[model samples]
Target: MPFYSSDSDDHRTPPVKMFGRQRPLHAVFGGGRVADVLLWRNKNLSAAILIGAALIWFLFEVVEYTFLTLLCHISITTMLVVFIWSNGAELFNWSHPKIPEIILSQSAFQEVATTFHVKLNQFLLILYDIACGKDLTLFLLAIASLWILSVIGTYFSSLNLLYFGFVGIAILPVLYERYENHVDYLASKGNRDMKKLYKKFDSKVLNKIPRGPVKEKKFK
Candidate 1:
C-alpha cells in the first residue's frame, strides 16, 4: 500500500490586497513617508516660528528704541535665540520622532543612547563648572549695567533706550552660556584618538585623490 492516501488539503491562500483603492491618511499628512515628516517636522516648524518671532521682536524694538539700541538688541537677540532654539529644537525633534520605535534593534538603540548620554553628561558637567566659576559675577555685572542704563534712560525719559537696554542685558547671560556650552562640547569631542583617526582616514582618502587639471607652466 501507498505510505498515505491523498486525504489532506492545503487551506492557506496567498495574501489578498485588502485596500486596493484606499490609502492611509498619515501618508498624506507625512508627505508619503512617516520618517521624512518625523525627522524634519520639528526643525522646519521651529525655524519658521523663531524667524517670525525674531522679526516681530525687532520691529517692536525699532519702534520703542533708538536706531543704535535697536540694532544692538537685534544683533544680540538673533545670535542668542538661534543658538538656543537650535538646541531645543533638536532635543524636541529627537523626542517627537517616536524615539523608541525609531531604533528598533536593541543593540543599535543602546549604542545611540549611550553616546547621547555621554555627550549630555559632558555638557552638564561643563555647565556646572561655569555655574561654580564666574557665573555669579557675570550676573551681577549684567544687572548693574542694565540698572545704570535704565536710570540714564529714565532721566532722559527715553523709553526706547531703556527698553532695548533691558532686552540686550537680558540676552547677555544667555549668549555667554551658549558660547561656553559650544566650547565645552567641542573640547569634549576633540579627543586625541578621534583626531588621530580622522587625520589618518583623511590622509588615506584625500592625499591619494588626484588634483584636478594642473595648468601648464607658461614661460615669458
Candidate 2:
C-alpha cells in the first residue's frame, strides 16, 4: 500500500488582481477593495446585493420626478431645476439685463457646422470601408443587433439595459464555471459546423467566381 502526504504538493494562491479585481460586487461593474467574505464565503449573498442594487438603480433612472429625485439623488440638475421652479423664476430677474449677443452668434453656428461636417465625413468613410471589407458578415450582424435593440427600446426603459447587463455579469461567471464542460462541448460543435459551412461555400460558390488580378508591388 502507498500513502500520500499533504506536503507532497505545495498549495498555490490565486493570481494578483489590480484595482480590486478580487472584490465581489465592485469587480462585477468596476474594480475595488477585495470583498473576501462576499466573494469566497457567500457568493449567493453577493449575487443578491448585485441584483438588488441594479433594480434600485433602474427604478432611480426611470423615476426622475423633481422632488422624488432629491431623496434618490437621481440627478443634481433635476434637483436644481425643481428648487428654482419652487422658489419662482422671477427671483433671478433683474430690472437691467444685458444678455450677450455672442451667446447665439453665427460664429458658434459655423464652428458647430464645421465639426459636424468633419465627423459626418469620417463616419461615412468608416461605414463605406466596413461595407467593402471581408468582415461584412460581422457588420451585418451588428446591424441586425442594432435593429433588435431598437425593437427592445420600444418596450423597456434604457436603464433596464444597464440593470440587466450588470446582473447578467454577476450571475454568469458562476454559471459558466459550473457548466464549463457542457459549454465547451457546445462551442466546439458550433465551430465545427461553421467550418464545414465555410468549406462548402468556398468549394461550390466561391470557386465559380472570377478571381481579381494581383497587383505588382512598386519598388521605392
Candidate 3:
C-alpha cells in the first residue's frame, strides 16, 4: 500500500523547472542599451582605422619638433605622477608613507601600480578613439594651415614636415588596433557579467512569473 501511494504521488504532478526566458532586469534597465551604444560608437571600423593610421603618422611628424617633443615627455611624466599619487593614497595610508610601507610592504605599492597600469591603458584606448577620423582630420588640417604660416618663423623653421608626416603614416594604425582590442576585452567582460546576473535572478524570481512568447523589436 505504501509503495502504491508513493507511485501515485510521483504521477500526481511533474516538477516544474524553475528557469524561464525572462529578460535580465539589469539588461532591461541599461545594460543592453549601453552595449548597443558601445557597439554603435565602434561600428565604423574603416573610419576608426583610418583615423588611427593618420594620428600615428602625425605623431611621428611631431615627434621631432622640440616643443611638441618636450610636451610629450612632460605629459607622460605628469600622468605617471598623478597615477601614483592618486592610487597610492587610496591603496595605502599615504599620510604616513613609511608606516604604510612597514605595515604592507612594497606589495601594496605594486597593487597600486597595477591599478594605474589598467587605468592608463583604458585612457590610451579613449585617446586613440578620439584622435582618429573626424578629430584627427580636423586637427591635422588646422595644424597644416598653421605650419604653412609658421614656415616663415625662424624658430619654427627647423621643423621636419616630411619626416613627421611619414611617422604618422607608420604608427597610428598599430596603436589604434591595440586600443580596439582592449575595448573589446572590456565589453566582453561586461556582457558576461550581465548575463550571469540575469541568469541568477531569472532562475529564481523570474521563473515564477508567467511568461509568454517574446516578441522581437526591429529598430532601424
Best candidate, lDDT: 2
Predicted candidate 2 versus true structure: per-residue lDDT over 18-89, tens digit per residue = 222344443442222223223333666676788677667755775544446555575676667666665664
CA lDDT scores, all candidates in order: 0.49, 0.56, 0.50
lDDT of 3 by residue, 1-220 (tens): 0111233433453322112114432232234322232233344653465465565545655454455776788799977876787778867867522323346557656655665576588668755665565554334545677687676454433334544454454444334334644544444444445556667877897788988989999999
Alpha carbon RMSD to native, model 2: 15.0
| Residue pairs with backbone overlap in model 3 | 51-133, 56-168, 56-172, 57-168, 57-169, 58-168, 61-164
Per-residue alpha-carbon lDDT of candidate 1 for residues 1-220, written as tens digits (9 for 90 to 100)? 1122232311122211122213332232223222222233354654454455556556665455656777798899877876777668777773322223354777656655765576588668756655565554434445677689778766654445644555553444334334544533333333323445657866898689998998999999
Off by over 4 Å in 2: 1-41, 61-155, 215-220
User: How much is the lDDT of residue 91 in candidate 1?
Assistant: 70
Candidate 3 contains a number of clashing pairs equal to 7
Per-candidate clash tally: 2, 0, 7
The candidates, ranked best first by lDDT, are 2, 3, 1
lDDT, candidate 2, at 157? 73
What is the alpha-carbon lDDT of model 2 when measured against the actual structure?
Answer: 0.56
User: After superposition, which runs of candidate 3 have C-alpha atoms over 4 Å from their true positions?
Assistant: 1-178, 210-220
lDDT of 1: 0.49
